[model samples]
Target chain A: MRISELSERSGLPVQTIKFYIREGLLPKGVNSAATRAEYDETHLERLRLIRALREAGDLPVAAIRRVITALEDPGIGLHDLFGTAAYAIGPRVEEPGDDPAWRAARREVDALLEELGWRVTEEAPARTVLAQAFVALRRLGFTPSPAALRPYAQAAAALAEHETGQLREDTTRAQALRMLAATVVYDQVLVALHRLAQEDASARRFGAS
Target chain B: MRISELSERSGLPVQTIKFYIREGLLPKGVNSAATRAEYDETHLERLRLIRALREAGDLPVAAIRRVITALEDPGIGLHDLFGTAAYAIGPRVEEPGDDPAWRAARREVDALLEELGWRVTEEAPARTVLAQAFVALRRLGFTPSPAALRPYAQAAAALAEHETGQLREDTTRAQALRMLAATVVYDQVLVALHRLAQEDASARRFGAS
Candidate 1:
């Protein structure tokens, strides 16, 4: 297939394909003649993966590059590859500034993690994200008690267990990457669904009609 | 209190407070003289609420204005106020193009909603969000079966139920708005916790050391 054919099949512009090649996100095709090259199934597959990462996962080119490297490395186990993808997709949370509210929020987050007995690292970006939420809530004069946060944690843990149960050892690299992309993108979907569900519940409990 | 004092207490800049006043997101302080005005505790409280909506809820000024209006409307019931806030925070999802894949995804979403017996409106932005997720999954060659989405919906519904149970009828308007802001912002917190939980589950099941 030529670049034009690749563009048509992948629904990406030719310039984008060229840009990806230049950025080392995609490989240059084999030169069949002067100014013309032939692409293969691998190119098409890679283009599809790139599209999924960009559109669905919303990952930057650098993160996608890391994922590609992890996929191609024989020594990177499946679990490790999943971890890399997870890290790439998680938002970068900045260090909290020194404030009484932030300090209290950080303490609350540390306690939640300890109580949950989750074996996540101290530097996990998720820790910062949780702390930020607590800080914001406290700033608004609504400190969520440990009792309020426990159910959410249990629900999250249940979903996580289900997500991990879906993974298998025999999954191919492309499939694994696709699964990871879906996992990250579906967080947005889950939030959306949760909001709708809240509306439904609110209506049942309070709606007039 | 003066504008400078309000800014100092709220941790907002004088310019931003002025902008909010000019934009009608905040009411102007009582005119004490030709060039100066006197603010009170109400101004400070409104400024704090605006900050919470902007920083925590990530709501646009327009949405925040709607929320303020709903809060000020004495006739609006507590449930109606929550509904207004929920509608304000839901993301606007663009309609997917007319493709076979999108059509299939939309049908799947419809079926899931019907199966769950959720009472969401037809034009709910979350409907489009769920459809978009399905389309993305299908495009990536990983169509999630109803079996896969069921647990997610269940988890989401459980969280929603827990969230609603926390609301009380005697809550003040400011407290209600704070609850809504916390609810909107806490989605990020929930996703972070979910990711961490997944890591824990993966480590326990697949970790080498």
Candidate 2:
């Protein structure tokens, strides 16, 4: 197919498609003739993935490139690939200078991880992410009790079991990539759902109207 | 106390405190004399809450103002105050036209809400948020089964019950405002924890090393 056809099929502008090719986000098509290259099914699929990551997942171009690179690397396992994508797009937590509040929060996070017996790396960005939240909570004078966070951990474990279960049965790399993308992006959805559920529960118990 | 004292206590720059006062996010201190104003403990508390909402919750100034206004309203109940904050910070899901994928996704969201017997309003931003995730999933060619979403809903409900339970025992309007701020900001924490837990579970099940 021609660039125009690829653009029509992918619902992207032809100029934007060319830009992606220039940025190495999409591959250049074969030069069948002068000034004209023919694309294939792979181009269409890649374009769709790129669009989903950019628009739906809100990933920056560099992060999307890292994800794509991981997907292309046969040496990377499924778990590592997922981790790569998550690390590339996850929130960044600035180092909290040596404040007592931050120190206490870090201790609490360490305790929670030990109690859960989970195997996340010490260097995982998520450790910092959780620690930052704790610091913020303490600064606001509201520390979450261990009992309160336990249900969230249990829920996360249950969801992770389900997610990993689905990944184990994958048939092709393309399918695996799709599943990984959905998994990472869906976290945002999960948070929204939780907030909505809170509203519903609040309405049931204390809504004025 | 004066503006400098309020600034020191709140850990905010005097200029930033003045900016918040100017923006109506914080109330102005009393005019003590020329080139000076008197700030009380209430000013310090409000400043802290404003900073928490801005930095931890990532709420816009306008949204924070709305939350503050709700908190100040004598007629507003605890539930309504929470609703105001949640509605203010929830993700906005723009209509995705009439694509079959989107229509199907919207129906799925509607059905899921019904099955859960949740009482979310029709205009709740979360409904659109869930629908958008479903649409993105289908576009990526991976439709999540109801079984997969059930655990998430159950977890959300459990967390919400815990959150609302705490508010029930709150003593004063000031305390309630602080609780609402914590609840809203902690959602970010919950998400980070969930991601960290998923990584742990993944490492246990499929770690390369």
Candidate 3:
């Protein structure tokens, strides 16, 4: 297929697709003439993956490139490849600042994760994000107890199980791309659903007819 | 207590506290002298709420003022006030674009919510958010079925239940502030936890020693 068809089918502009190819985010199509190149289903799939990461995951070009590079790396196994992609689609945290409150929150988050017996690594950016939320809550004079956090963790674990359970004997590249996209996009979906659910519960309890 | 004391307690600079006062996000302190005003616990609490909304909720000053206005309104019930604040905090989505994919995604999300029997309003910002995520997913060649979405909704509902359950007989002002802050911060926390759990699951399955 021509680049124009790829652009139309992917709903991306020809220039943007050209730019992606230029950025090495997509490979050049097989050259059929001086200026003409032929694209195929792989290009279409890659374009779809790129668009999903950019639009839904809000991942930067650099991160997308990293995930692509990892996808092409035959040395990395399935789990580690997924890990690389997960880390790339980041709520990537800066190092925890040297504030007593932050340190305290970090310790609390670590303790809770340990208590839950979840095997998240120290370097997982989500740990910093979780700690930061705790600090914010505490600043507002509400320290969420481990007991308070338990339900959230439980829900997270269950949702994670459901997400991973979807993976089957699919091709590695396709599965990784799908999983990567789902991880980022579903995070947004879950947030929206939670807010909607909260609104419903508030209406039921607080009388907003 | 003085403005400086409020600043010290809330960890906001004195100038920012004064700015909040000037912006009407906080009421003026009682005048005690020509050059000074007396502050109290209410001021401290308001400052805490302001900081939480700004730092954790990422709410703009305008939105913060809207929340503050709702908080001060005598007629709005607890639920409505919460709805106002929740709307103000926002994953406030733009209206869906005039694209077939987005419209289709919106219908799918609306149907899923109906199937789940949740009493969320049609105007809920989260509805748009959920639809947008679905569109993004579909753009990548995946449309999530309600079956795939059910666990996420279940988790969201359970977490919402836990959050609302915490609102037992606290003063209206304090409870509303706490809930608003939680609604925003917890969304971030939940995203982080889900990612961490995914990493753990990936590690366990994919030979990531």
Candidate 4:
């Protein structure tokens, strides 16, 4: 197939495909003449894999080259290739269903934020955080079954949304938001603050002892 | 305060604090004498900020230095500082509370898997898919409240947990785990895959119908 056909089949652009070839991520085709050349199934498969690596994995082109090269090595096993591919995908989890229990938890969290006088971002969700954590967890050897972590996911989402809303406060909008808030790195500041509050508050009301 | 006091208060070891100073992430203290230096609240505040940038924001020392320098410029506005800090942390929002949602999502996802008669993962959470998504979302933006994301988190966790368990079936345990499951760079792959899926899936499920 021509470069356009390859792009259509692989869902990549001809320019990108050409760039990949120029960047050595893709090997040049066998010399048919000075300007034109022929490609084979190997090229198509390689192109698809490259698209997979680039689009889904967000890998740098250099890394993609190394991945494809490694996969092409006949000495490697199929398991290794797929596993690498999976790793390359990084995190592969998603929400399994739309359930009421999940919604109830969100409602409870929303209410807590309201009671605490916080701005609630209704559309905020925690799936994104799970994605980053998934990459770390996958690295840690726990594939994590959904049954084990659903509660955490839901709770986490609410927590993150509520917390960020704090950053966006407009009470002192005339002054830059940075001045009203501590100039400390936002994540650590809130995480440490929340944790300290959680520990002290929980102990005060429902002492572990 | 002495370095020891600073370390204790900030929960950072003295050596790391010293490293931060050496790396220019922290401002130098005024000299108390020819050989010693005196530190104070300004130093403490800076150290806390440093910790936040490194851990939550994952800013490299060089990048953190750049952010600080940018913010120090009197001509620069608060909005620019915020954007600079965000870039330093990596091109993503550092929203908190994402983990719990993922954990919750992982839980419910498993129950659904059992209902479907899918071989559930012992190590992976059904929310594995969501877990991956969380990482992605964080990379994209880190603001979802943990509680709000519960359902999405749990469901994705369940799905991923189920998908991940299948890896073992394809190859030797050691090989699969090492090549695909263990490599840190697998994130490189998973990130790409998730993105590809997102583009296609969103088009299929949410595009104009």
Tens digit of per-residue lDDT, candidate 4, span A1-209 = 66667777666688887898998777777777787776676676666556545544566777666666756576754334433443444343443356454444345444433443422233223223234444444334344344444333333444333333443344222121111111112222222222222222223332323
| lDDT of each residue in B58-106, candidate 4, tens digit only | 6577877876687567675433443355334432333245577656534
Please, what are the lDDT tens digits per residue for candidate 3 over residues A1-209?
99999999989999999999988999999999998999998898888778866865588888888888887888977777777667766787675559888898888889988888777778887888888888877766776788877787888889888777777786557456666666778888899999899987887888745
lDDT of 3: 0.81
Q: Who wins the TM-score comparison?
A: 3
lDDT at position B180, candidate 3 = 64
Per-residue lDDT tens digits of candidate 3, residues B1-209?
98888888888899998898889888899999999999998888788777777765688898888888888888977888887777777787786559887888889988998998888888888999998888777767776899878888899899888888777675656556666666677777788888888887777777645
Candidate 1 TM-score versus the reference: 0.80
Name the TM-score of candidate 2. Answer: 0.77
lDDT of 2 by residue, A63-125 (tens): 888888888889998678768866765665876688787778778888888988888777777
Docking band of candidate 3: medium
- Per-residue lDDT of B1-209 in model 2, one digit per residue for the tens? 98878888888899999899899988888888988889898888788778766764588888899999988888998777877776776667687777787788778888888888888888888888888888766666666667778777777888888767776553566665566657655777777777787787678777866
- Chain A TM-score of each candidate structure, as shown: 0.83, 0.83, 0.89, 0.42
Arrange candidates, best DockQ first. 3, 1, 2, 4
Report DockQ per prediction, comma-separated: 0.55, 0.52, 0.70, 0.02
